[model samples]
Target: MTPRTTKPQMSVKDFEELARRAPEFVRLEFINGKVQVKPVPDGNHGEIVMWLIRRCMQQRPELSLYPEQGLKVEAYRKGRARPDGCLAPEENFVGQGEWAEPGGVLMTVEVTSRDADTDQRDRVEKPDGYAASGIPVYLLIDRDACSVTVHAEPEGGSYRSITTRPFGAVVELPDPVGITLETQKLKDYAD
Candidate 1:
């Protein structure tokens, strides 16, 4: 049987209290009263996140990094978001509290899993959410397809720059955060 997709309706406040209090199972972001439970990424996704973190640490040791972490945004609604991994420019922002506040985020990454709906959520809905909140960079890693998509320069309600890197390709983020990504390492995820 197909798992039912409809989530119980919730007010933003109620959702916040419930998520903060829940003990087991992964919780997720609620948009317009709808709930979404993010998938627990497979081993390949975990490896890729670790590999990317390692590379970023080597190239930009000054930045604080977060993996599978959640952040509180939408202050009134008390909504939150947890990206697969993220980078913060300096030490002050790296702490135990929420980390998804707008411009405070230098970059956010999402490693696609086996679910098509989840992929669409990351590729479409997430960019909208991130861009609307002013996150400057969003990186998407698609190991199943061996590709990377970078979304930058938010305009209106969406990101202006969209670049895809296929397997064995190299892609570079713009200045300030001039980190070059090696797409080839992504292919090793398949092994």
Candidate 2:
């Protein structure tokens, strides 16, 4: 589901409190000064994540793909996003609290959900937020577009480079990540 904006924007503190009290089944995020309820993953989403897990493990065994990792994003660690996958060295967040700083995160991934505002949230706002937070890369698996986008080289609150490839193409997640994905397999899980 595309995140629906709640009425009367709340402070990050209040949002964090509410998110803590939220039910286990619901996922929450704070972005662009609005509270967003994340969509539940469907079977396709699960398969895609699993596929990524296998690929990442095969290529970079030193790192682990952490699912739904709560990250402090945007300026001044004001925004919180639970990326679909956070790629970092093993045990990168061992002692962190609920919302961990994005200091050592190599990359953050998001697989698009079947929702109305995905383009706005994922394609536009998310990259800006992640870039501002200085996360090295933001990988967006756009199910609706049947494509994958790699956002890298964050400078002045935006990514200097943006590359998008079709599902069947070879996608390279540039330096720091240095993983080339054979996205042909992703075609099988396309929504």
Candidate 3:
């Protein structure tokens, strides 16, 4: 008879504990009871993230932007996500723990990396997760496709509206964050 073996599923608590103990260079996330790991982003990714942060700060001084902040996307699910950029009211994180519950988060941004699975997660699974968590916006920068996508209007565990634009175009963010983002400066990973 063949030996029976099964991979152990990690709970949200377990994931959080493991992530806390992980090295600073490692990025860890729990998605649908599965642990996902990735190395720290490259220079191009950091540049784009900083660019977006600067732009958002210039436009909305009252809001707070954090990079790679862990977020609780669902209470019932054993998963925690660390978005590339997270926008929220400054007060939301006051006296909070390491992971912020997705209550006052206005938007989350993801800049795709070289991995196809990473791109797919940003394009598909993440939107659903963010929406279900009541986040208002999910921005995806697709390096592979040279496009940016904004998803909003969360309902039924998904965003009801989506808009996509090429790298050179100006994408208008929705109200409450009424600002236009210039994507022309966003160079592809190959650059």
Candidate 4:
């Protein structure tokens, strides 16, 4: 006879309760019926996020910036998936109202950590999710290899390989937008 093995799979409500209860600690997400806890932002992660947020804010102070916040992109679906940084275009920006709108964000940035697998997820799965949700640009800052990968041109359910820039290099943003990333800052905490 084969040995039986089992593990608990948490529901979205359970995860939400956990997040609320552990608000002071780590933020949790329910992905594929699994509870994924995001690592506390180390110094590098925090600096990068802050830099991106400042840049976006300076460019368009009128637009709202949602950084690493729980975003409910669709009804009946609640995922604690927080992008390292996200910029909501003026139109769909969550206004100073009661409930939050699913901000039709123009860009979502994910800064990779020491974990190699998470980097892969950010490169592959998360971009797919962002593209599926109509995000125009997904910038990935990979500290592990010192490179910046900008995923765009969402076609069919995924983004086509638009362009890739190395560390200390600057890549021009596509049309309708003009943004630039400073990879030099990454050298500080680069793995």
Candidate 5:
């Protein structure tokens, strides 16, 4: 018979400690006690993220847009995620710790990367994690699939609604943003 083995799940404190020890140049996420390290984004990824930042800023000058901000999702499991872009009022993060809890976050955007694990997190785990944490909106731009998915109305550990649009189509964001994002210029890395 084969021996059974199990990986020890990290406590929230342990995850926080790990993040604190990690180098500033790297991006890290704690999902269900497992740590995921992401590489620095490529030019295409940065371009898309910057475009979103500009558009969001234009729409709501009062709110602040932060790139690659670590977010704490969920109280029990405590999933820690860093989105490509985070939109929130400045007050929410003024005196907070390095990681901000999801309560004050208005929206989070994730652009798919070359890594399969990173893509999976953006497509699958992050939406559920953010929703479970009560974050209002989770936006995923999947380069592999050439689509943008908006997940909102979090409830019961999942998003109650999801909307998807192709690369060239405009995606209409909900309240707090209420802006139609132009995706025509967002090119896939393979392009």
Candidate 6:
């Protein structure tokens, strides 16, 4: 005899209810109709987010890089996700609750975590989700690959243009998010 554990596929409303009651130590996301457990940030991950925050503030002072923002995503806004950072005009989320609508979001930033699902969650599913939500840009800081990939020009549930630049290069984030990043500093946090 084997002990069994069952995982039920959750709807958006159910997922939100569970997430609300979940302890602070746990972070949850729903993508592609599956419940995802987002791991806590390690020191390196925190450092990278901090680095990006500084850069975002310097280039676009009117915007803010909000960390761990829960957003309603996917087609029909049926999916829920929490990007590592969400870039939008300052005070954009003042009146919103837990899962905010994706409008007015200039970009969604994800720093790859050292987890089994990083590739699927960060690279594949998330870009699709953001693209489907019509967010203009998706920035992925790939620590393992020592690179940064920018996904822009969302259309038809995907980005029309995708560009990847290795760490230490001058990367342009494209229009709607015209910030140019000097990612040489990212090389330092690639642990």
**Leading candidate by TM-score:** 6
Locate the minimum summed-lDDT window of 10 residues in model 4: 1-10
Task: Tell me the lDDT of candidate 2.
Answer: 0.89
- Per-residue lDDT of 165-187 in model 5, one digit per residue for the tens? 98989899898667789888775
Q: Write the per-residue lDDT of candidate 3 for residues 1-191, one digit (tens) a residue.
A: 11111343766778889999999888887765567785478899888889889999999988878898888874344458899999987777777677877878899999888775785467776787788787888999888778889998888778888999989899998966676898888855425
> What TM-score would every model get versus the actual structure?
0.84, 0.94, 0.90, 0.78, 0.89, 0.95
Give a tens-digit lDDT track for model 2, residues 1-191.
Answer: 22324543888889999999999999999987888888889999989999998899999999999999899998778789999999999999999988999988999999999878677778887888899989999999999989999999999888999999999999999989999999998898886
Question: In model 6, what are the clashing residue pairs, if there are any?
Answer: none
- Ranking of predictions according to TM-score: 6, 2, 3, 5, 1, 4
Name the regions of candidate 3 deviating beyond 4 angstroms: 1-8, 75-77, 188-190
Superpose all Cα atoms of candidate 4 onto the true structure and report the RMSD in Å to 1 decimal: 5.5
RMSD, one per candidate, in order = 4.7, 3.2, 4.9, 5.5, 4.1, 5.0
Candidate 2 error regions (>4 Å): 1-8
Q: Point out where model 4 deviates above 4 Å.
A: 1-8, 73-78, 90-101, 175-177
Over 42-149, each residue of candidate 4 has an lDDT whose tens digit, in order, gives 888888778777866776686555677555432234344667777776646445332233446777788886654575456665776666565677888887768888
RMSD (Cα, Å) of model 2: 3.2
Model 6 earns a TM-score of 0.95
Candidate 2 worst ten-residue window by lDDT: 1-10
When 4 and 6 are scored with TM-score, the better candidate is 6
- Looking at candidate 5, the ten consecutive residues that score lowest on lDDT are 1-10
In model 6, what lDDT does residue 168 have?
A: 100
lDDT of 3: 0.80
